[model samples]
Target: MAHYLPTIGFGEWVTTVGEVVHFTGYERPLDTLKLADPRDVKLGHLLGTADMIAQMADRCYLEKCRDRLYPEFVLGGVALPLSANGDRAIKYASGLDLLRQTPEFMMETRKKRLDQTFNQAYRYIEPLFDGTNPYLDAIERSLDFLKQVLRSESWRLLRRNPQVFAAQPDSMTNVRGLMVGYFKKVWSPD
Candidate 1:
């Protein structure tokens, strides 16, 4: 049960903690998202989250990129507002596709324009190193949990953010194996 969402809405969720949210100036989300409600932004942002979306695309490509991808589960069901802590990605499906079609395949497939979506995403996530960045931490934790699931059960993401579930191995076995390595060293160390 995947949610096919468009652009995100604005002011639906508090972007930051202890901050006042003003949607009266709700022009940005209206302008950016197509058929979007600010409330749905959280859902959209969840989809936009790097590991989440990357895994989304990977799930889409599970059969194709299985050897290259890991797996992911569905996102939130109950409508949650967007957080300034949106774990947005650079456009995941596209990025994972790039990974699958690298070394000139995608470049040649497209109009010769460099697709830096994943790189752009990587750049956005650069600020996660030092302190407690909720967004970065979310991805980190999700990845951590994902790795654990991978090592222990070879499962996929059932849900992310507040809820994480592992079911079937969807796609991206290569990525799954990478995650397994992480769990082998990090969480399940014994």
Candidate 2:
């Protein structure tokens, strides 16, 4: 959930980035859950490792959203909010409306903005891992793949069948494998 916010539009967080970041436990530590008691060390380690793996899976799902789901929604005419509503504002335009209004510049600008936002959001979750964050690694890999998709002549195929593109080598299966492999290495029931 927190990882997804990085890909969110600026309009979505104009006034609430702090709240969103805080609510996502951006600065919090999982170490707080570690028990001081000696007997519970093993259990605590297992639980913490499990939580980390879960976060990694969450990151993989977010990548899937960026690579596959978002295009579906946009092409499908799924309405999305373009900006935060003000107290005095009676109505607001959808993202599609904004695009339709200014197709020439909006698409490129929007993509840049979304990419920047995603990077900023990634920074928030980064410190939680102290340089060992699997979720951040997953997002970086997805972003690299996304860059390739945008650069090549294959974007149309991606738009037509995202599921296929999503299933490629660095897709969810590999992400899962990374998480599972990490878990196996870090946690052992001795």
Measured by TM-score, the strongest candidate is 2
lDDT of 1 by residue, 37-138 (tens): 554533333333444334333423333333332232102111122346853232223323433333233234122211231222333444666543454344
TM-score of every prediction relative to native: 0.21, 0.26
Q: lDDT values of the candidates? A: 0.34, 0.40
lDDT of 2 by residue, 10-125 (tens): 55543343332332232444334334544344333333334433443453443334444344433333323233552222121332233223322323322442233222233344
Identify the runs in model 2 with alpha carbons over 4 angstroms from their true place. Answer: 1-63, 66-131, 156-190
Native-to-model Cα distance after best TM-score fit, residue 177 in candidate 2, in Å:
34
Clashing pairs in 1: 14-84, 15-84, 48-89, 62-171, 66-173, 69-172, 69-173, 70-172, 73-157
Query: How many pairs in model 1 have backbone atoms within 3 A of each other, for residues 3 or more apart or on separate chains, i.e. clashes?
Result: 9
Q: Where does candidate 2 have its weakest 10-residue lDDT segment?
A: 86-95
Candidate 2 clashes between residue pairs 3 or more apart in a chain or in different chains: 6-118
